[model samples]
Target: MNIAITPFFRTLGEVADVQIGPFGSLLHKADYIAGGIPVINPMHIAPDGIAADPEFSISDEKAASLKRYHLEAGEVIMGRRGEMGRCAVVLPEHAGMICGTGSMKIVPSPEKLIPEYLVHILRSPRARRELENAASGVTMLNLNATALKGLQISLPPLEEQRRIAGILDAADALRRRRREALALLDTLPGAIFAEMFGDPRDNPLGYPARKLSDLCSRITVGVVIKPASYYVDDGVPALRSVNVREGGFDLKDLKYFSQQTNDGPLKKSKMKKGDVVIVRTGQPGRAAVVDEEIAGANCIDMLIASPKEDELLPYFLEAFLNSDAGRQMALSNQTGQVQQHLNATALKGIDFITPPIEEQREFTRRLDEIRRAKENLTTHLGELETLFASLQSRAFAGDL
Candidate 1:
């Protein structure tokens, strides 16, 4: 793709006026069921594009106040805090939406800039670096309207801008297709789980139903007394509450514990090859199967699990525990005011149905196949994302 270089590069503020709305304005959180107004927050702008999260909504009163900063179809919205530089172009479908204080709205001067072109530029890595530099705060970072308005941006001719955005848009479409394929890949395991076990709550599979404790030899919470300073680079791999993924441990970035710390509790929490690890806090109901690679690793305070049983397969149990049914059970059992937690006793009481060993093995086999497919799709998507980033980088550097 060939892109013409502009006579002169300029700052975005020089070509377009930045519109700053009122400060400290609050929007009432709206429920998805109520179907009132859609409120845009930093989280709503995903890495790929705008995502429709059910959690985003605004009350009628707050919606009325947002009329002042009402988004137009072609304007761009960017997060100013936490996820700074995350940008999205407002489409007609999102015209009536309101943005929170954490996001800044940008409207380009129509004569000098194309909205789609500006969106592409803002999403580039260069713009992200600028936004990160502008962000300020000790505990939580934030970007002010003034800093955003002063950020530099290169400008091309209007015709060139449209052509460049067109090429990028095509690439973006391919990226979205890969994402949809990945989503479908994820759904396969859930579908297979539902087919094999039926609903655990309804017990339509005609399998034996028992409380989780009845099947396991032992179940316990993880070690908590270890200090943060006790963590080392290569002493012994320690599983923090965050290590457990949906179906297994993600050992990509495991923490290490020092030899000086007491290994007594660590030994007690030491996971076996077939044991199940469930997150007891933070993200509840998240569970994983402990494989041989992490057989001797100890789990942190945020996780708990059960020893492997003869009647049940660890992989099957992990899949079931991470399903929608398991999440509901964990949520109901959770107890806390600010941070919710599930103790070993509560987790033990959760009931699940177990199929025959042959059927369990069959289910696991099918799940493994689906997971392999998903892994392939995920790898392809990652490659595509890298290609997209490279294009964006080159595009902004006047080499597109």
Candidate 2:
């Protein structure tokens, strides 16, 4: 195959019309009306596509006033502020919606570029890097229409563009299916919990009610005094409220504390495998178990619950804390005028009906299987992403 790399690079402005979204000053909160035209903002530009927030919409009357911002099918909507390279192609369903204050519209010239191919090009890592480097802002990066329009692309024949886009679309679809599988697996643990124990709210199983303190050996708060001072380049990992997900941990942006600190002042906050850590403030009931990966980790501003092991299992407690009834119980007991936080006292007092130890073990067994499946699916999804990225690089380099 002959590799063609010459006489193809063209500025985006030559192939597409780039226009900034409406200014914040032009769209006020008061202009938003329920059941109105959807506004596509930076947050709305999700990995799959536009995830519109109903609250951030404008009335048809309000949308009419900003006619220039009206979207047309086949146009690409890109976020102009904060994270760069977030964009989605407007489908027929999205037509007539308004572009939001933090986004911009890119209308590709059909003869020069197809919307599908253009979306892939802009979403590529190289394009994202260019946008990030060119964006300007002191606090948060912002993309200007001029800079966006000036971006260059290795233009290919329409037939070749369609072929590459089709290949990438297929690979992306596989990744999406894997992701959907993982999402479904995530819901399994909750379903099992409901089936085994019934809703904790009603205790339909007629299990005996008990405070969390009665089941746990101890309940306490993690290191809360000047935790920032213990930051180190690399040492014992420290868990924070941000790291706690509903039923797992998000290790991204994890901070480390000196081992000396972990063994000394923060020793009380040290977590062992099977320990449960709950969020203290923002997103108050979210919790996760301390797995072997971060078994000896120390935490900050989290409520640590050590299961008796003989009576209760950490996995079971973690699942319950993430359940609907558990969340409501946490929220109802939360105290604080400014931040509404769940403290050790509040967590210890939260009541739930205790199931038999044998039943608890059975529930944890099912949870383990679901989580293992999720891990395998997650690994496959990552591999598919790497393959898709390679295809994007090659296709744009005129090598595919």
Candidate 3:
């Protein structure tokens, strides 16, 4: 059953006070200091909430100069650049923090709008689409105070707004817990590695160390050619730095290459099962093994290591490279002053302990078990996300 109510509407400007953050010229690089007030930027507006970096904090003197930019409890902080729908409510602890150049602050009138409800509405898919349409810029979408203020908002009675917000909050809480559980599951593989083989740096078991190249048949870079020029609507998927996670592949935002490109220039970069793809630049040192599902996929600017089955298992080598000790070794070999990267030559020279093939196989079996559990949890999380989206849609449609 559905109940329909004629809700009065108002422009965001009428029901709230909206203001953009300080201009870039107002807050220079020198203004930033350690152990000071944190600035809430677009990048800091995470999916979970605002994750302020202390490194971007400013001193009290600097903050006082920008006093008008300080955040207050219950206010909404929204990203003004890059992606739309990036927002979070300022909590009690976040009060006194400064707004960043890439953000905007919104304080809704309590009599007309509930801050939580407004945040929920702004984060909804429809609102995001409206915002994207209202935003300017072809390459980087941006929202100005005028654009934000002109946006129309549905204003149901106060109690109805609370009802919708409460329902959405409960659903969102479930999703958050599901994500937290998945994160906990992600740590199991590393823990297993630590328990079986002590840190490679310490070599507590006194395992013999060997050059990474000695254990691999081939170590090389992925397609160095400009891969974007070879993109196609449908063909072999081309993995990039974004596709690789710390211990796994994200597989989102993947570009594709035409079959012609795959057979021609991309032939050398075509991956096979058991090969490892390591990030080269953005987030260096992260590596993940190529499973059968994506065996024939191509990659761009990645470090590919084809481990010899006799000397080192692909899973074992990937775990080593992603381990704390392995990351330190990789970092030591990092090149490039502006953007640190791990080249094939540097990766080949990395020193790591050589565990017995039988022990490596045992670890692989345990890791496979953990992966299966993760897959199940991941599927459940996907379902929860769908349910939340549906709830948001219904709630905003006056169908809840």
Candidate 4:
């Protein structure tokens, strides 16, 4: 319907009243006589909108007392803290759900604005920027009930709002498809590993098995005495524990350290091309092969492996280290009361199967081919994701 923009562009306070629940009331702790009522929190509202899953639950008894805050099928709910300005329209399927104190419900007067249209407006960049500016806090920013209600939005006709939302929705779907494709690609390596080697625990292949220490000449922790002040724009990059991700190293976000830092521990911490870097602390067993570019880089206290034979490919070892068997071994050996950590001494004892030299080369070659194909697919997906974001930016800015 072609409603005037002036009437539709009203603050949330003008359209509906802000309701508050009892102090220290937990949404999940509420009583529900019928069944479990879905409780919405900041975490429940994803960047895309309403998440497919709910992290918490609530009962019907406590929900009844906060009836004013109860959401209808089309009411908009905005998170007021943590992830500020995240908004979602309550779906018809979620009619009985209750929202937490960190969320504020916006009941639109239907004559002026449509629920889905208002949701898009609130989630747009312009509206989010304004919310960020008004949010107050030292550690964690929060948009109070008053600030949320008083936020302004430029409204277009209901039909125009619907059209804009439709375009953005289509773009968002494309982005999701790309993400799904990338996830599928990640499964290929694991599947191949299982088929060729069988379960590492059971060792169905029954090849000659040896501890990691037997196959490698050296396995030790990286440097730890280096100072942060030695880091420079163009100097030797120090691979801290955080620089490593599950599949590979992220050189793009690397921190540099001066080559002259002389921290006494540099002798044991130098990384070579054929070395396998395994995370010993947080996210145990996560590892990656050091590529040629980062061959001489100094590593932190994380475990580094230097294999004794050219017969064993570093990539193949990395694949195994990231496998289910490697993770289980690392987790078992980890020590600590509060935060567990894996040490080089424990890692050396983890068992792995080794085929003949020729067979290892053949396996590595085939694995590389599969990884290259996955990389190509990932590249295309990233392009599609970028395109979708650009489309969203233009559509919301009224350029579309």
Best by lDDT: 2
In Å, residue 219's CA in model 4 sits off its true spot by 1.8
**Candidate 2 lDDT tens digits, 312-365:** 899889888888877778667435233368888778887867899999999998
Ten-residue region with minimum lDDT total, candidate 1:
24-33
Misplaced by over 4 Å in model 1 are: 1-7, 24-68, 94-102, 210-214, 226-230, 250-254, 259-265, 302-310, 326-341, 346-352
Worst 10 residues of 2 by lDDT: 330-339
TM-score of 1: 0.80
Pairwise lDDT winner, candidates 1 and 3: 3
Tell how far residue 336 is off in model 1, in angstroms: 17
**Highest TM-score model number:** 2
By TM-score, highest first, what's the ranking?
2, 4, 3, 1
TM-scores for every candidate against the unseen true structure: 0.80, 0.89, 0.82, 0.84
Q: Which is superior by lDDT, 2 or 4?
A: 2
Residue lDDT tens for model 3, 75-148: 99999998998998898989999999999999989899888888888888878888999999999999999999
Q: Is candidate 1 or 4 superior in TM-score?
A: 4
Q: All models: lDDT?
A: 0.74, 0.88, 0.87, 0.71
lDDT of 1 by residue, 13-64 (tens): 8776565543543433223324566667678887566665545665677667
Residue pairs clashing, model 1: none
